[model samples]
Target: MSAGKGLFVSFEGIDGSGKSTQARLLAEALRADGREVVLTREPGGSPGAEEIRALVLQGDPERWSAETELLLFTAARRDHLERTIQPALACGATVICDRFADSTRMYQGLSRGDLRRAVDTLHDLMIGVEPDLTILIDMDPAAALSRAKARATAEERFEDFGIGLQEKMRAGFLALAEEFATRFAVIDGNRAPEAVAEDVLAALKARA
Candidate 1:
């Protein structure tokens, strides 16, 4: 699904998988190629989502449960889609997102263990739009976690996570990518950022 006239390309992986860097690189690459690109992130992009993102990522843990966190993410995604993503797509822009529906399916589903339920909740009632392409950056969880620990400001409710959970999340992402291989491209995020960007561009061209 082109999601309409434009393309919806998303970046997804575990927390420290370098999606932000790749997304920026891809956006720059697209612009350099003379295409209009919009760079955005889930639980963000729009004002409402940004606020919800702060609440979900930074608020007291006591205020949010697994289900609550999932719901907040859904709300942010809905708002982001309606206010930012859809319009950008409709205007014929290539929307490069830092993360999307897959992130929720993997993270929240791993945290809650009901992947089907999470997927159902997000798409069952919507207009039913899926991504055109999903770039999944593959990185070793242990190494990614070490980098995150060294660089993070305050841990999210999920980032205080054990190594086991991070591994589970990584596996979940890979499994989900397998399920949607046609739209999923796994890039080696363990390499240098420049190298990863090159792989990303090549993977995208291959997909195209």
Candidate 2:
């Protein structure tokens, strides 16, 4: 905890699982309550990380090997932690991040290859911090993938992997929640965005 006792929260799930929307809503709700809130996203929070985000998120799915992608993501995360996250926490601001290291654990560690150990090791060594609370929006893979593809954004490299990857990611995320149960909250994301946001707030209150 910081001198001001800031709270760090992160949202994670399969692509298009509405975690981003929930993160945003949570930030808004906190702000409405007069709390200082800092909303950010992984792989692109800081300037250097944003540059790396383009390299990793855009282009072909195979633009980089899984091992390479892991390195790149770790690098971006380090810069994000130093420049964006740490500063906000130091200032006693609630930091609500869209995605974080757990996404890297799924995408490059499990889904892409058997790099779970490597991911953990790198995380412990380079980025030895985890969110005080991690809210995972659980949902059906097909539905989430459909919503993801509907956006048709350039960040579709991972989405382009199709439903198979989405299914794998969903299961992996669920397992991850269990693996880190103490800091993890699983919320059903199959409902409307407002409903999901309500549950997110409830989860935060429970954690508090």
Candidate 3:
């Protein structure tokens, strides 16, 4: 919503809820309509951020304490904003991010209730940017965990937390959407990808 700047859209949901796929589909659809779009993801977008991504996502999930993880994520986000996101928006390109600050809020804050204030405070002070629109792909945790497990990757630290954590994450995301209704579009992600993509497009058009 920056003055005359391009649209900023972010996808958020529990792992394997297909938010990443939906974000890509939306970007493709926008480009088909002749809109300039930039597709990116958090924890890694710019060069410096990607390096940080490796540090945070690889190895043991307990490699960093909750506070340390938050700091790393914040640092990466700052770098991404400075090097990638801001530049794209300045040039009037719709930037579609796979995840944003909402993920940090849900993962870090909801995981430990007391940390919510810290996350918001750090965000306000260091990373004040918020997406113009955030698409939350809601899905059952069991299904999402299945989908997430099917994809084998070295960066499985987040997924390693297992089903219980994913269920908590789903609830956290839903609560967040309700809290920020004006900027959120909640989409059912239990259906087929094509169907979900159609719904996502419809929601974006409605907002537009």
- Pick the lDDT winner: 2
Output the worst ten-in-a-row residue range by lDDT, candidate 1.
118-127
Clashes of 2: 0
Residues 72-109 of candidate 2 have per-residue lDDT tens digits of: 99999999999999889888889999999999999999
Cα deviation in Å at residue 39, candidate 2? 0.2
User: Candidate 2 versus the native: TM-score?
Assistant: 0.98
The models' CA-based lDDT, in order, is: 0.83, 0.93, 0.91
Residues 34-132 of candidate 1: C-alpha lDDT, one tens digit per residue: 998999998798999999988877745455767777788888888888999999999999999998888777777665556558666665565266789
Runs in model 2 lying further than 4 Å from the true structure:
1-4
- Per-residue lDDT, model 1, residue 29, is 96
Query: Against the hidden reference, what TM-scores do the models get?
Result: 0.93, 0.98, 0.97
RMSD of each: 1.6, 1.3, 1.1
In model 1, the clashing pairs are none
- Order of candidates by lDDT, top first? 2, 3, 1
Worst 10 residues of 3 by lDDT: 106-115
